[model samples]
Target: MTNSKLLKLPSQRQLVDRLLHLIEFNHPFIFLSGKPGSGRGTLCESLLNGLPDTVRVVSLIGSAAMKMADVRQLLLQQVVARPLFNPQDALADSFFRMLDGKPANLLLLIERTDELPADLVGELWALCRHNDTLASPHKLAIIVCGNDVWCRSQKEALKGRAMPALELEVAPLSPPEQRIFLYEKAKELKIPTALLPKPKVEEILNGANGHPSAIMQSLEDIMTDRRPKKRQAELPVKKIAIVLALVVAGLLGLSYLPLFDGMGKEETREQPQEGALPAPIGSDALETNAASGAQASGSAVNGDQVARDWQSDAKTLPKKVESETVTTESTNYEGRRVVISDEVVEKLMTQPNVSGALPTEVVNELTGVSSAGATQKSAPATPSAAQHAQPSAPTAQAAPKAAVPVAVAAPKVALTPVSTLNKKPKNHYSIQLMGASNTQAVDSFVAEHALAGKVWVYKTRFRGSPWYVVVQGDYASSAQAKTAIRKLSPALLKGQPWPKSFAQIQKELKQ
Candidate 1:
C-alpha cells in the first residue's frame, strides 16, 4: 500500500503502541508531552479514534481548561454510570465512584494540563492513589496532554502517584518522513506525481522545516498557482515603476483638489469694495449746537439793539437750564435713598431676633442724616411705627403677670385622660401563590394541614410557558418551605412540584 494517503510523521508507531499499552493495562494517569506543532493533539485524536465506543473521553482546553469545578461537573454529568451529589460532597465522592472496579472504561483527556493549579493536580493525584480503597470496582483513568515546558514543570508534582504514568515526546519528521509526507499531501490534492517536479517539491519541504502543518500549507500554495505557460507574462522594472508613479500622482491630485478649490473661492469672495463711508453718530447734538449759532447770527443781523436783547435772553436760558438739572438730580437722589432705606428695613426683618446691642455705625446710618434738620423733620411727635411694634418691651412687661396663670393652665390639660389616642392593630401573616397549575390540590393540602387562610395560589406564566406554579404564604424562616414540602408530599400531589424560593418563583412568573 502506498504511504501517499496517510499522515507520514516520525514516531507514529511508538506513540500508538504506548497508548494501546496504557489502555490495556488500565493505567489511570498518562501524560503526553511534545513541542508545539509536533502533533500532540493529532496523536491524541488518533488514539481516541482507535478506542472502543465503551470508552468515553472528555476533552477540556483554554480558559475553561483549568477549572476543577468544571472538570468535576463534566465527569459527573457526561460520564456513564457517574454518581451525583451536592458539589461540596461531589468533589471527593465522584472521584471514588469513577475509580470503582467496573468493567466500563473512561478516559479524561485534559488538554493544556499545565493550566490546572498545583493544588488541583495534587488532589487528583491523591484520588488516583486512594480511590480503590474508598469505592467499589471500576477503573478510572486520566490522560494529560501538554507541551514539553509544562511537562517538565509538573514532573515533580506527578511523582509518587499510584497510577503508572508515561511522558511521550513527539519530534519533527526526518528527511525520509518529509518525503513521504509531501507525497501523501500531493496525492490528496489530486496532483500527478510527475507534474509537481522533484526540485519544486523538495524546495517546499526544506522551507517548511519538515513540520507537517507548514509543509501542507506550502503544497496548497504551489497547487493554487498552477497556470498555462502561454498566458503568463512578466513586466520590466522600468515599466512597473512608471505605472506605479502615475497611479500615485493621480491619487494625490484627487486628495488635494477639494481643499485648494475651497480656498480659492473663499479668497475671491472676500475682495474689498472701492469706497465706503463710515456711519454718523451724535448727529442730534451737532444739530442743536448749529441751531444755537444760527440764532446768535440772526440777532446780530437784526441790529445792535437786538444783539443786546439776545445776550440777556441767552444768560437767562443757561441759568434756568442749570436750575432745572439740579432739581431733577435732587428728586432722583431722594427716590433712590427711599428705596435703599426700604431695602435695609426688609433685611432687618430677615435677621433672627437675638439679644444684642445695635452697632454705632448701623444706628447712625438708620437714624443720622447729613443735616440735623432732616432727622428732626423725620422723627414724629408720637413714637415712630417701628418703635411701637418692638416685641421685647411688651413681652417683658406682661411676663410677671401671666406666669402663674400659664402654670395653672398646664396642670388641667395633664389631668385629662390619655386614652383618647388610637393604637394600630398587629399585622396578620398571609401568602398568595402565582403561576400554579393545580390550585385546588395546593388549597386542599394547605387546609388539611391547618394552613388555611394563611396560604393562597395565583396563576402566571414562566419563561414563556404556561407551566409555572407559585405558592405564597408567610414563611417564618427560609427553611420552613423545605419542611412544608415534606409534609405536602408534592410528588404525590396532582403535579410534581419542587421546592423553590419565593424570590425565584416570583422572578419566573415575571418572565
Candidate 2:
C-alpha cells in the first residue's frame, strides 16, 4: 500500500487528482499501469476522497487465473453487496441491473489487470467503451490497472486495435521519496522513532530502495523487534553443564576400552564390501508382508467385519449442534441475515471489555458464532470462575453497540441518528426486535439492512444477562406504530410485534 504521505509527492498528487477530469471529458477506459510493489492498490484507496461526490468507486481484485465466471462473481459482491449469488447471466449485464434505479455515477476499478487473461481485459475495454448504451446513460466508467511491462506488451500486441485513450503509468518512487514514505507510515502506525535505530533504519531503507511494499515489510520487522517477545525459556546453567559432563565421561570411559579401537578399525574389513551392498526393503514391502501374514493366520480378523463395526459405532454417535438461521419474511427489499448469539457471546457483549475491535477468535468465542455466521454453533462453555477465572471474569462483564436491519421506508421527519440515541427521547413509540448479547451481530444487522430511518440498539443487563434491543422507527402514538407494523406482511414479524413508547424503551435501555 502507498503511504498516505506519498500524496505529498507532486507526481502522485497530479496523477490521482486528474483521474476524474480525464474520465468525464475524455475517455472512459482509463489504464493505470504500474509494476508490482509500486503502490497500485494503495493509489486506488488514496483517490477515494478526491473523486466527485456523485461518483461511487467499486474496487475488486482480479485473480491471475480468473475465469469469466469469477469476474462476474467479483462484480456481484462489490456492486450488489451480496455474499451469495446464482450465476445464470453475464456479470456485465447483471451489473447494469443493480444500477437500474440507483442515481449515483459508478467507477468500476478492476485491479491486477495484468494478471487477468487478455480476453477478460478486452471484454472490460469493450464494456467501458459502450457502458452508456449497454447500461445507464453515461453512468459507468471502467479502470483496469496492472504492471507496466505486461500492459505495454498487451497494448503493442493489439497494435491498431482499441486501447485506453487516457493510458497513464505509475512510476516507482525515488530514493528520498521512500524515506519520506516510511516516516509517514511509522507515524501512522504509532511506532516510536527511538524504537528504530538510525543505522538499522538506514540499512532497511537502502535495501528497500523506493518500493512501498518493501519499506512496509522493513517497518514491520522493526516493530516486531520492539515488542517484548518471549524467548524460549532457557535451560538452567547446571542442567546444561550436567549434559556436557555426561558426554565427556562417556568419551573418557570409551578411551580405556581396547574393543572400542578394534570396533572403529574393523571398519576397514567391512567397508571393503560396503560399496556393493544391496538396498534394504522399503517400508511399503514390510507392511504388505505383515498384512499377508495376518490374513494367513488362523485367528485372522475380517477387514469387512471391522469396517461394519466402525460404521455401526459412528451411527450411534451424537451429531454436532449447528448454527440456526432466523429467517424473517421479507418484502424483497432487505439483503441481510441474523444469527442468535450463543450464551457465551451474549455474556461477553454484556460486559464492558468491547471498546475497539476484538480478535476474530475472541469474537467467535464470546458470540458463540462460528466463521460461517451461525449464532449457536455449539453450547456456550460454562464459566469456571473457581478454576480458569481470568478469561471468564472480563467476558461476564462486556457489550458492543452496533447491530443491523434491511431496507425500510424513510421517516417523514428527521429523527435522531443512532449515535445520539444514548439519551431516552421524548415519549414516542418504536418497534422492538429480539435482543442479542453480541454487539457485532446487532451492528451488522442494522448496517447491512441500510435501515434509512432512526434505529437504536438499547443496552441493558436483564436478570444478569446483557441484552441489546434493536428498535426501529419511533412513532408519536401506539395506534400509529401498531398500524405501521400491521400494514406489513405477516412474514416480517418473526417475533411478537408490540408498540413500545420512549418511556418504555428508556426503562428497558436503563435496566
Candidate 3:
C-alpha cells in the first residue's frame, strides 16, 4: 500500500504526526471522526508509509463481512496462510500456540467502522487493549475512519469503553488556497503559461471557490480552447464609420425637402376655399356639356384643385383634430360625443337638428341630394333668421368679457411658511450625523453595534447637503455608545475612542 504514490491530501499534518506517535508507542486502538472528504484515509496511509516493510498492513474497509465469525476466519487466513497480516489476530494466536515469544509489528486500518456490529467492535477493542491473553510480543494498532454522524452513533453504542476519537473538520479553501489549487491543476494539464495572465488566473480560481475538483475542471475547460485577441481590433472602427455615414445621408435628405414651406402654402389655399359654393347648372345641360363647354372646364379645374388641396389638408388635419379631441375629451362638456354607438347614429333622424337646424348644405351632402337650387334658396333665409333673432347683439358687448382677463394672478410666490422655515428639520440633523463620503461605512458600523430590536436607523439629507445614518434616541446613554465603540473598535478605527456626544458625532459625519 505504501508503494502506491498518491497525491498529497490537504490539512491532516497534525493527525499524521499523532498517528505516527501512537504507532511508535504501540497504542492499540484509535478512532477518528471527521466530515466526509476530511482526509481520514489519507492520514492512515501516511502512517503506514512511515512503518517498516516487515510490518504488514491489513486494511478492512467495513462491509457486510463484519460479523465475529467472518472476522475470525479473516484473522486465521492472514496469520496461517500469509503471515504478512499486520496486527493479525491469527498470527498472535499462532505465536501463542506454537512459538509464544516471536516478535512482529502489525497495523490494521478499518474504514467506515460504523457499519460493523456494535458488539464486535467493542470486543475487538477489548482484545487489542489486553494483549496479555496472547503470548505474541508483536505490537498491535487499529485505526478506524468514519463521518460525524456514524462516529457519534458508534461512540454512543460503546457506552464510554471506546478509545478516544479525534474529530477533524474539513473547511472550504480560502481565496489564496483556491489560486494555488488552480495553478497546480494548470501545471498537471500542461496548460500554456501565456494563455491567461496572473490576474485572469486569479479570477478563474476565485470563480471556482477553492474546491480541488472544481479547480481542475475549470482549468481543463480553459486549456481546451485558446481565444484570439486580434479579432477585436478592427471592429469598433468599422462600426463607427457605418453609423456616421448613415447619419450624414439622413441629414442631407432632410435638408432638400422644404417641409414647413409647403405646409404654410397649403394652409393659405385651404382656408380661402373652405366655404366657397360649387358651380351650379340644370342636370341635363351640365351632363350634356360637361366635355365641350368652357364653364365645365372651369368647374373641373376648381374641383381638381380642391381635391388636391383636400388630400394635402387631410395630411395636416390629424394634428388639429387630435388637439381638439384631446382638449374636449378631457373637459366636462356634455354635448360632445360621449359614447359613439351604432344605435346612437341610427336614432340621428329622430333628433331635433336632423334636417331643419342643421345647415342645408351639410344635409344635402349627407342625403346625396343633387339639387343646387334647394341649397341656394335655403342659404339666404337661414342667416336672416339668425340675424333678426338677437334684439341687442349682446355677443359684440360680451366678446371682451369673454376674454375675461383670465385673472393670471401673478403666479403665486409659493414661499415656504415662516413656521416651517423656523423648525430645523430632522434631515438637517441626520445629515450632520452621517459623515460625508463615509455614509455606508457609518451605517454598517451602527448596524453592527446596535442591539437587535432596540435601535432604529434613519437616513436623510437636507437641500445641498450630504446624506446621513442616524441611530435615534438610544435606550442607553453616551456611556453605552462609548462601551459599544470600545467593543467594535477593532472592526472600526483600531481601538480609538468614540465621539463624546451625538451632536459631536453628527458634526464629524458632516466633515
Residues 1-511, candidate 1: write the lDDT tens digits. 1232233454675666678777757655767787766666666777776777766775666353446676666556666454554444444566555545555466777776776644555655665666555445345677777778777666655766545556667677788887887787777788767768878887877776756667777777666864335855766989889999999999999999999999999998899867654333222322345565455445432233222112333533454333211122356456553223553455456665634864333354556533243343344555455357663566565455334321111111111111211111112222233233544545445544454444434445545555524344445455664555555544334444344544544444345
Candidates ranked, most accurate by TM-score first: 2, 1, 3
Between prediction 1 and prediction 3, the one with superior TM-score is 1
lDDT of each: 0.56, 0.64, 0.52
Locate the minimum summed-lDDT window of 10 residues in model 2.
303-312
Q: Per-prediction TM-score, please?
A: 0.39, 0.40, 0.33
Span of ten consecutive residues with least summed lDDT in model 3: 406-415
Residue 103 CA error for candidate 3 (Å)? Answer: 3.3
Candidate 3 lDDT score at position 451: 29
Identify the superior model by lDDT, candidate 1 or candidate 2. 2
lDDT (Cα, tens digit) per residue for candidate 2, span 85-179: 55556555566566565654678888887777567766665555556454445566778888887777666543332444456788777777777
User: Where in model 1 is the C-alpha error above 4 Å?
Assistant: 1-10, 26-28, 62-66, 80-83, 86-91, 97-104, 115-120, 132-137, 162-164, 191-199, 221-511
Roughly what TM-score does model 2 have, to 2 decimal places? 0.40
The deviation in Å at residue 240 for candidate 2 is 17
Residue-level lDDT of model 3, residues 1-511, one tens digit each, is: 1112223334444556667777778455666776654445655667677776766676777776567556655554554444433333433344334324666576767777777655556665555644644555467676777777776666555444334534434334566555655666667667889966888777776665544445555566677754344655455888899999999999999987797779888898887655766555433333444354435435443354321111233543454333221122525766664333343344454566664455544454455564354434434456567557765676575355334332111221121233432243323221112233344455454556542343333333546565443343332355565555555435444434343444443443344
